[model samples]
Target: MTDLAVTLLLFFALVSTAIAIALLRSLFAVVMLSGVFSLLAALLFIAMDAVDVAFTEAAVGAGISSVLMLGTIALTARHEMKPKRWSATPLIIVGIIGAFLIYGTLDMPAFGDPNAPVQTYLNPDFIARTPKEIDVPNIVTAVLASYRGFDTMGEVAVVFVAGLGVTMLIGGSGGFLRRRYRETVLSRKDGQA
Candidate 1:
């Protein structure tokens, strides 16, 4: 009841900030707004009683991603180039998808309904067995590090492969390194003379 209200309020606030960011011309403001949106999303997750998701969202979304965006901004211009025309096709598709997702929410059970399938099935077992199966406390980390370690390993591998692909695509035989190599060879020949 109260949690739903808080979640809705936070969600609306996040959406409003995102809209304002899209409307603004300033890159820095957009980045800040994105950070705010991420933070609000983390809060919304907490309000929804998804503490594990909230923790990850807070750390990765609001913390790491915002810092990465800020670093990107430092290497680029603060002002975006004005586009000639706005495209509406992507926006229309996104709006339709968002509307459908929102529509799905109407069918969902109210938050903290004791009879809800989610509340009835897994929560009690985890609550009961966590302290016994795993001696150390903090069930969330225990589940992640022990039970879901394979998923974590796969995720790490995927990230590593993506990084390697990006490095090969962008950094190979192009940009600063090629120019630096040319300069080094030229400077060595000049020194010999």
Candidate 2:
């Protein structure tokens, strides 16, 4: 009961933070709220006993992501520009996708069901094999590093690609772009004087 209450509270907080992010016009507030949202999501993951996932969310989502966004904002605008016009196409597409996702979840087994396929099969297999196959003292480390190494590598590659994309988008040569921007501003001021 206590766990359920905590999970529910975290879920509520996550939703509230998401709504606030969507509604706000200030980029700085949005970035900070995004960090808060990530922290709330990390708490939710912890509540679900996924400490590894929680740690990743806190580090990447809350910490690194927030810092990157702040940097981007520093190079861009503090406030979001007002939209020229509102369109329902995006809202409709999102609604349709959300409905499909909810429908897909309807067929999933209940959370923490003891008889679930993963619980009955994979868990025992991993537990039994960890000591012999991997010889790693920490089962979690063994599983993540050896058993699911390719998946982990893929995730790392994704993060690397995302960071590279952000860097390219911000400025291909980050410091050079900043220097150019400063020169442009100074030159404009000199011309005005």
Residue-level lDDT of model 1, residues 118-191, one tens digit each, is 87887688767778887658777766776678988999999999878867755666657877988999999999
Most lDDT-accurate candidate: 2
Off by over 4 Å in 1: 103-107, 166-176, 181-193
Best model number under TM-score: 2
How much lDDT does candidate 2 score?
0.91
Model 1 poorest 10 in a row by lDDT:
166-175
- Writing each residue's lDDT as its tens digit, candidate 2 over 137-178 gives 768788999999999899999989988987776656886888
TM per candidate comes to: 0.75, 0.80
Backbone clash pairs for candidate 2 read none
By summed lDDT, the worst window of 10 consecutive residues in model 2 runs over 166-175
Q: Which stretches of model 2 miss by more than 4 angstroms?
A: 135-137, 156-193
